[model samples]
Each structure stands twice: as C-alpha cells, then as structure tokens.
Target: MVDQRLPLASVSDFATWEPVLRLMLTDGTHRSAGRSARVAGRVSRYGWSLGHQGSLSSTRIAVEDIQRSLARGGVQEVAFSAEIQPDGRTTLGLVWPSPVVEPAVGYPDLGVLVLAEGSLPEPWLRRPDPVPGAMPAPSADLELLERTLRERLPDAIGATEEEISAAEARLGVPLSDELKVLYRVTRVGRGDDFEAADRAGEAVGCELFGLEHLSAVDAAQRHPGWKLGAKRAVRTGPGAAVQGLAGSPGWTCFGSNGGDEFAVDLTPGPAGHVGQIILVDHEQSLGAELVADSLTDFVLGRLREDGGDRRGDQLPAEARVGTGHLETIQAAAHPALEVLSVGPGDGTPYSLAPVAGLPRLRTLTASPGTLADALEVAGLPGLEFLELGAREWRVLLDAGAVPRTLKAAAITVRDERHLPVVPLANEILTLWNRPRIVQTLLYGDLGPGV
Candidate 1:
C-alpha cells in the first residue's frame, strides 16, 4: 500500500490515469523501504502531487512529477526506470548508473525509480525496474568487492557500457545483481560524481578493503577455491602502484579468499621483493610443486643482483637444514638436498642441501627417523645444526658421536630425559660444555613443569 502519484500526458491521456500499471521496484521492498519512506516524506514536504488535468478532468499531472518528488526527498541511492503497461500501470527495474543505460538494467520500459541527482553525479540515468514480486538477485559481497577494486583501479568502475562489457568479456564473469543495485545507488555515470561509494552496500559491512564479506557460497558460485589463487592484479604504471604498510612488495590488493598464496624472493621479509614471483596455486596443486625451479631461479637472480653471499667460495662449510615443511621451506630446497632429520616420532621433517657451486654442504635435516639417525648425521665433519630431542640424545650417546664441530643447534625434549656424560675426555661433556654455539631452547609438553 505504498502511495505514489503520476501526471497525465494530456486531457486525452486520461486513459493512462488508471492504476492498471503494476509497480515494480528497482530495489525490492526490503531494500527500498527507507527510500520509499524518504521519498514519500519529501514529496509530502514539498506539497507535490500528480493527478489528472482539465479542472477535475483538466488539471492532470505528468510522470515527471514522480521523479521530482523522489529528487526532492533527497532519496538518491540507485537509479530506476518505469514501464507503462497497457493496463495503465508501470513496472520498475534497477540498474547501474553508468553513462549508458544497458549496463544499468538489461531491458528498457520495465519501470523507473526516481533518484536524487547530486547523490550520484555521474552522467547516468535511472534504471528500469523489474516486474512486481520478482525475487531480487543477490550480489551483496561482489558489490562491496567491486567498490574495493575501484578504489585500487579507478578506471574499472563507472566505465561506459562498451567499456564494462568489454572488461566483463575479458574477465569472463558476469556482474552480480547486488552490484547493479550498488552502481545505481551511488549516482555514478550521469553526473560529475561518478566515483562515489554506494552507501547502501557499505552500511551492511560490505567493504572495499577486506575479504571477510566474500563467503564460501559466493566464491563457490564465482571463482571457487581451486581457481581463485590465480587471479592477480598486474600493474605496469605509477597510477597502478599499490600502497601497503611498509615498502614490502605485498600488493595492497593481495589477499586470501580462505587458504593461502605464497610469494618468494631474495629479500629478508616473508614476502621477498628482489626477483620476486607469486605462487597463486595452493600447496595441494601440481603447479605449486612444479614451481621449485622458479624459486631456484629467483635465488640465482638474487645472487646475481646482490652478489658474493651465495657464491660457492663464500658460504659456510656447515650443512643447511629446515625445521618446517611449510611451502616457504619446500620452495627453498636445492638439488643436493641431504641430511634428513631422522629422529623418531617428533617434530616436522625438513631437508637441505648446498646450492651446487656454493661453499657449504656438510649437513641437512630431512626426516624425523630413529634416535640412531640423529647421531649418524651429527657425527659428520663440519656438523651444523642438529634438530633433536631427549630420545635422539640417548641414541647419539650410545653411538659414541657425542659432539664434533657442532656450532648451532635447536633441541626440543623433556628435561627429565637422561643426559649422556663423559668424565675423562668429557666425550659427551664437550657436547654440553661448548658454550660458544648459539643454542635455541625449544620446550616440549612434559605435562606440568617439574
């Protein structure tokens, strides 16, 4: 029972004054209620009404009055259109307020929803409304996502129909229904304020900055988890340069839809910038596994740019070892990957090797095997880091390879475990006595501290 008024074209246009026209809203009732009330209040405030003309028969108003009424209400959120039905009713539809009409609403003459002019100053027109009672389509998250995309790439949003259509064809995805409403509400193409943010979408936590709003449902329907990581924004100009905290090459636009994406480079940060590349594929993907050579190439490139450190003559003689199987470490391996951490049943497995033609290549961590494997590897010349526990210590003591030139180490085991002692030459004593080595203390869950 929402009230509305219309104008009569002429005295002869009396045939058009009847209510045979069915009302269709650009934004469905739930979305447009505030707008409807605001429009009604403004129209009432302005003392405006559209009725038939010719005295009682001559004093008729025009449909434009509806537009003026909405305009006066300060109700400019989305643009809408109206379709005149032969039954004397009008159907309305929603659209994105682009310079052209087709991108706003797909069809013409459905119905028109009036908009506030200054709200969306872009050179755009109102969108035609859908048929009455039609279910409004959903794009709640995408609308926000596009807003964010626009913030990063201003040229992409509010583009002309031909431009948007071309981009859509290129992207291979269609815009969502909610996104259309968002475009309309902001008053984009028709006026000077084409880049305005759609307040309606923003009110419901649909933001242009974070990925929290994008749901599994939306991702499933659009890109899905498997294909999502491959999507990246590539920029070739200063205007396209993304801003982020710290100068890290982490693109402000780079974000996870749920899982993870890896970036590798020569720099010290988690995201390496020098000779950088991205792995959009997840850990489970074959493409991810195949990218090892790419990482090595990056390392080589870094060595070439930075020089000396990675050269065969400069690296330390000790072996390289990894403690985690994370993608970062897996991507770090060289062909000579050796010295697996073979202690039984504890901690993550890691592998390491000398980047061929590099200096050091004495030890590495590969798997968590039995206690005996720990001593076997630790006894080797130029011993580096031995990631071990109480069990491995006992095995090493039993194997008589207590300590050698071992320099740095990370040990994680309960303190109660027996320590191998050497009294005379302090055979095992040298292992505990050498204080120069950088010892990293790692704790194990021994229930409660003794």
Candidate 2:
C-alpha cells in the first residue's frame, strides 16, 4: 500500500504517479535517490499497453518510447473516461469524460506508484513489434457471465423476459459471447459501483477504464502497470465485507453502451446486522455463480424458527427458499427474511402469490399473479409503489382490471407485446367523462403536474 502518511513533494507530486514509484525501485538507503530516473523507468515499463487491443502499434516499444519522451519533460495532460448507468434510465453511462495522466502510476495493493517528469505517456502510441505471439488470453463468455452475476445478485440483477427481448431487438446484432458475459457480470446482482484500473486491479477510484485501455492490457500480458483501485463494497452481514478484485477483468462492449447493477454479499460486518451490501462489479464474471450459490445456501437460515421476519436472528445459516417454502411462509407470523438480492437461484423463475391476512404490512412491491390476483391488492389501501414489470403488467392488462386504490405505478413494457390493452387515449377520454376526475395522464404525458 502506498504510504498514506508520507508527505508528497508538490501538488504535482500526487499527479505524476510515474515519479512517485522511484522511492521503492531499489532496496538500498539511497534507493529513493534517482526519483526522476525511476519515474522514466516505470513509464517505459508501463506505458506500452495503454490503448485498445488492435489499435496500438508496439506494446513494448511504446512503453519504452513514452518513458523516454517523459524524461525530456515536455508532456502535458492526460484524459480518462468511464461508464455509468443513469438513474431511472435503463441505459448504462460514463461519468468522467477524461482524466489527466502523469509519469508515476500508483499500484496501491502491490505498494508502488510510478512517477515521471514531463509529457504524459501513451501506451498505444508506438512502432510495431517484430516478434510473433501465441493464442489470446482466456475471456469468459457473456451469457454465462450474466447468469453467474445473477446468481450472486438476485434482486439487483433484474431482467424480465420482456426486457431481455428488447435488448436483443435494440442491438441490431447478437451480443458477442464476451460482451454478454461482461454485461451480466456488471449488472447481475446488487446496486453497487466498481473501480476501473489499468491491468492490475489497482486504481484511484471506480473510474471505469476505456475499452481501448482494457484491450491493450489483454493483448500484452506485460506492460506499464496501472492499478485498478478497490471496490467500495458495503458490509454484507453486520459489518463490511469489502472484497478487492484480482485484476482488471475483461470488459467487451460495442458502440455507445452503458448500464448498471448492484453487488451483494451475505457476510457479517462489524454491526450485528447483515446490512445491505452494495458494489458495482463492472468486470462481472460468468464464473461468479458458484460463489453466489454457495453464499445463498450459507446465509439462508434453517427452517422452523419463531416466525416474525426472523432475519434479525438469521446468523450464518444456509437455506434454499423454494416455491414450497412460500406456503410455509404464509403460516408464519411474518418470518424475518433476507432474500439474496441477485439473480434467480436454482434455475427457477420466482412466482409467488402473496397470502392475505397480514395486516401489519406497510408496503408490497412485487409482480404478483394474474390481473384477478393483483385486483385483490385493491384491498391494500396503503400500497405505496406498485412495480408492474413487463410480465405482470401483461397479466393485469389481460385480466381487464384497473386497480382502484393504486397510488403510483412503474410499468415495464417490451416493444413486441406492448400494444395497449385499452387505448391510452380512450382511457383518458373515459376518465374525462367522470365528474370527479380532476386529473389525468394520457400517453404518459401528464394533463398537469400536481
């Protein structure tokens, strides 16, 4: 770890990561003597693999050349950009358009930082290598990666059958096996954030690296080492269970794409509660399923507890909440529950019909059964937010029931089967016919904002 205590030389001291690493190049007392020389050396060692996979000319020579150029001290600014998922919007996003780069590259976990004097190094800018190479490194398939991510994140990794179809439709081309894997891993489970690093998983923060940066690193196993920082993981059980990734996992994306997903864990933290843990796994992996499943079983406390949402008592336990368990849940007096908020568990689609009689309920956010079953929810006068996702929305519209007491609704509709059950315009006209209908929403455009 970079000594958090050592006072840096100047404001530039912090910026030029290339030069900062000179302090550790050798083991002797004056090991920190040739700070400038070490900065150039680190730059030469790290800058080659900085751009996209096929974009860079010489991964090795590029590193050496950049280091030499930086030695002369003529470099100016470096830029960085990362992806993000906008709120309420399904599309993924990029937050930082760019960042300034310098000589020293900091590797927090390995306890090293690079420092250079002048111009920013370009890992991609170089002459071609005259050597031959072998097969490429192994990258996980996208679909499998998504499934694995879902296994880890049940609730946070949501995708109705309709949304999946919509995604396929919008892309115009089938999602590459690799891209799919990355998408699933990044957005599979809990709501969280991930940090972007060069090749090593060491970074300043969760600023996602660009595709070019990732590709170049994958192409060349060796290059200037940039640290992909640690993930800001929330505590799983009572306290925090922050797990750092090994390296910058492969991220394969296409033109203009971005999205978000949350990360979750059942581990206990400092407090006695298994609080909601959150992190963004941008480099989500397809192989995460085994880990996720094991966690779910470990955390699903045993059966036969004193009812009443016993999540408070749910210490390190393992369980499988099957459909059969739902009826047993009805028998309980509101058993405390800590449902893993990630992908579908045990390859089963979850469809539960909530039993009536629990008057203590204040909120019910679920996609229940057919329209008839949801109409029963009219009894829940206190219902806050009704999420009638694509599948359930179809059920309600098919049931021909318009909930009377529903306060607000967030509906999911796929372009394929999203034809209006009742013409939106006609519904508005009918509401206009009502004498007490003082407000209305037509075509999703409000008559007036209240």
Candidate 3:
C-alpha cells in the first residue's frame, strides 16, 4: 500500500530504494545479479524491468512496495542505479523526467534529452537537396498507365479536373503526369462500395487512399524525438537511386502495404528516375525503398529489390565505435561523418582524435570512461548535439571547452556516483542560456552490499 502520510520528497531518499535494490541484487535472473559491479533498472506505471529481467515472482512483492512508495509521491516512472564502493559504502541513484524534457521528447524512454533552448539536430533540419536536372524513369508511360487502370477498373469514377487542381494548390506541388492520369482514371475512396475499393486496391497492388487523403511526406513527420532523431544522419550514397532523407515533399503517399505507404517519388535519388515509386516503411522515420522505376513498372510487377548491407571503406554518416561494432575510432572517421557514439568496452579507453575534425560531424555521445581523454571533445568543432557521461562532461566543463555549436545535449549515467547529474545538466543549459533541469537530491545510506 502507498504511504500517503509520508513526505513526498523521500522518494529521492535512499531509504525508499533499499528494499527494491535488495530484491534486484538478490533475485535478478542474471548470473551476475548479486555480485555484479552495478545494478540498474527502470520502474514505471507498467511495473518494472531491468536489462536482464522483469518482475520475477519472488521479487514482485518487494518491487511493488517501492513502486507504491513512488506512486504516492506522484512519480510515474523512475530510473535507479546502484553500486558498492570498493571501501563498502553502498549508494543508490534515481532519475525522472524534468519539466524541460517534456516537450523536447515524446517520452524519456531511452536517452534523456538535455535540450538547450528547444534546438533541433541537423537531420531534423535536413530537407531533400534540390535536383534540378532530374527526369522521369524510362519506364514511365502516362498513356499506358492511364489506359491500363481504365481497363482494370472500367466502371470506376475518377476525380474531377477541379479536384486535382485544388489538391495541387493545397499541397503546393504539382502532381506528376503519371499520378494525374491514375487519379483521372479512378480516384479511390473508402466508400460504401467495399468490393469496388478492394478491386481498386488489387489493381494498385496495395490499399489505395482516396484523392483527399494523399499527402506529401516530409522531415517533420519523421521526428521520433530529439534524443534519437537528433542522433540520426541522412546520407544518400553516391550510387543510391533514392535520396536519403527523413521525408520528402516530393514523396506523395497514395496507398498502403499494411502499415507502410506507397508513394510516387518526384524527387528521385542521385541515380534514380524522377517519378519512381518508393515504399515508405512505417517502422523507419528516415528514407524510402525504391519499389519501381515508374508507376507503370510497379503495376506490371517490375519491382526493384536491394540485397544485404551496403558497406564500403566510405564511412557512414552515422556510426558506433568501441567494442562490438567499429573497434577503433579510426574506422569510423570520415569527412561526411555526422553522428558518432562511443560505448563501454574492455581494455584501454578510446581517444576522440580520429573523429575530432570531421567537418560534418554534429553529434557525439561517449559513455562513462569510454574516452581516454574526455577533453579531446573540444577538437570536435561542429557538434550540435553532444552526450557524454557525467565525468566526461565534467572534464569538458572544468576546462571551459563545451562546444558552442551544441543545440541540444545529454549526459549518460552509469552508476550511483553519476546519479545526480542534474547540476551538471543545468550547467550545460547555462552555457546555452536555456532553462535548467530541476532536480531534488534524495540522500541516504543502504549500508554495505551483500
């Protein structure tokens, strides 16, 4: 049961977390549960979960107790991490969303956003570059496209010329010839005639939306959150047939393959045709898959298929280094590098030297102790969003070298020592003259870890 009589601020105190930690340290399913160097997990209205386990039956009761304590205190969700000092001093740390973090993120689900005055990352601001010389695919045939659709849906009703013109004016873009012809033959709608709409979908190879429902996809719609979206990099390879973008106004979505949308890509990739068909996957907020070189090809089942991971010596605009992926920073360094993240690993720490001067690099995230020299971040001149562990940021702060180009930032926490980094986060906001992250410190001792 929740203790309504108890003071609300005790949720930050160590006494509130001791029972939860005891169960976590003793009952976690992981082999390292009790003896591990540290323990961390998230608790919310959905109950609680750790990196390795959920609320195991044996620990459920105890877990609920702490959760109740927090609920009565008005906390919807909280993250806690704990570790025992080598000298045997046990400490616990807790974190929750601050007022500044609310609007900058959909939810503080993964990385917390320490936004600096509502700034956005580079990718969020990325629009498809103008391609003036682009042309339609050789497979394009407006006459054949219109004739074929009319043949399949002979009794269909098409959109009026006035409707098409109104759509163009409303969307502020002209419909490609192929698109106009398709609409002229049949403007699909979710009408009472389910059988007719289904037949139209079958002819279209996907569920078709009505003329009024068609909309151009663009970058704003792809924004997941500044924390994740800001870290993404859009790089259209030299040979790519589709322009890598968050979304494109030229991508006029007209149908759906379940959750994904089918669009006529008026703004093609560097090696693509102007009016190619592209599949905008619902799961991905960035880019589209080329379906066919033209609407004619799409209906004829002449679809494009790509195989396997596209890799080369040319570094991706975004990359992860340290341990499992790119072992060395040298492997990730590239002039086109836009986002770089460093994580924890064994052996010696990494240096930021290899990736320091990349002109396009805008994001940098180094986990606690991942960087050999934290101050080397000063060499990264173009960073607009930077995330580092508290200690790493401390090094940068002490040196007065926080990157001035940062639009938003974050601080990663690994253990109890780095638990209350709100003061540090506020200092980050101070540099940008932004509102501070409000934090209340709740201190207590849980004694020694067993």
Q: Estimate each model's TM-score.
A: 0.22, 0.22, 0.82
Tens-place lDDT digits, model 2, residues 193-270: 442122111111123322222221121232232221110111123222222221112212221113422222222123
Q: What is the C-alpha lDDT of each candidate?
A: 0.27, 0.26, 0.73
> After aligning candidate 3 to the native by TM-score, how far in Å is the CA of 189 from where it should be?
2.7
Ordered list by lDDT, greatest first:
3, 1, 2
Per-residue CA lDDT of model 3 for 341-370, tens digit only, reads 888767679988998788998888888888
Q: Where does model 3 exceed 4 Å of error? A: 1-19, 27-38, 52-55, 58-76, 82-93, 102-110, 190-193, 307-316, 319-321, 324-333, 343-356, 370-372, 416-418, 440-450
lDDT by residue for model 1 over 1-450, one digit each (tens)? 111222112211222222211112212331222222101101121232221112322222323344453455453322222333222232332222221111112222111111111221110111111122322112124445445544544443343455445533643434333333233233232333423333322332222211212111111112211111111111112211111111122111112324544332212222122222233333322111111112223222222233111113211221223333222333433433333333323344333221322223333333334332454454345433344554555566677765454433333322221111111112333444431211111111211111
- With a 3 Å backbone cut-off (N, CA, C), the pairs that clash in candidate 3 are none
Order of candidate numbers by TM-score, starting with the best: 3, 2, 1
lDDT of 1: 0.27
Worst 10 residues of 2 by lDDT: 88-97
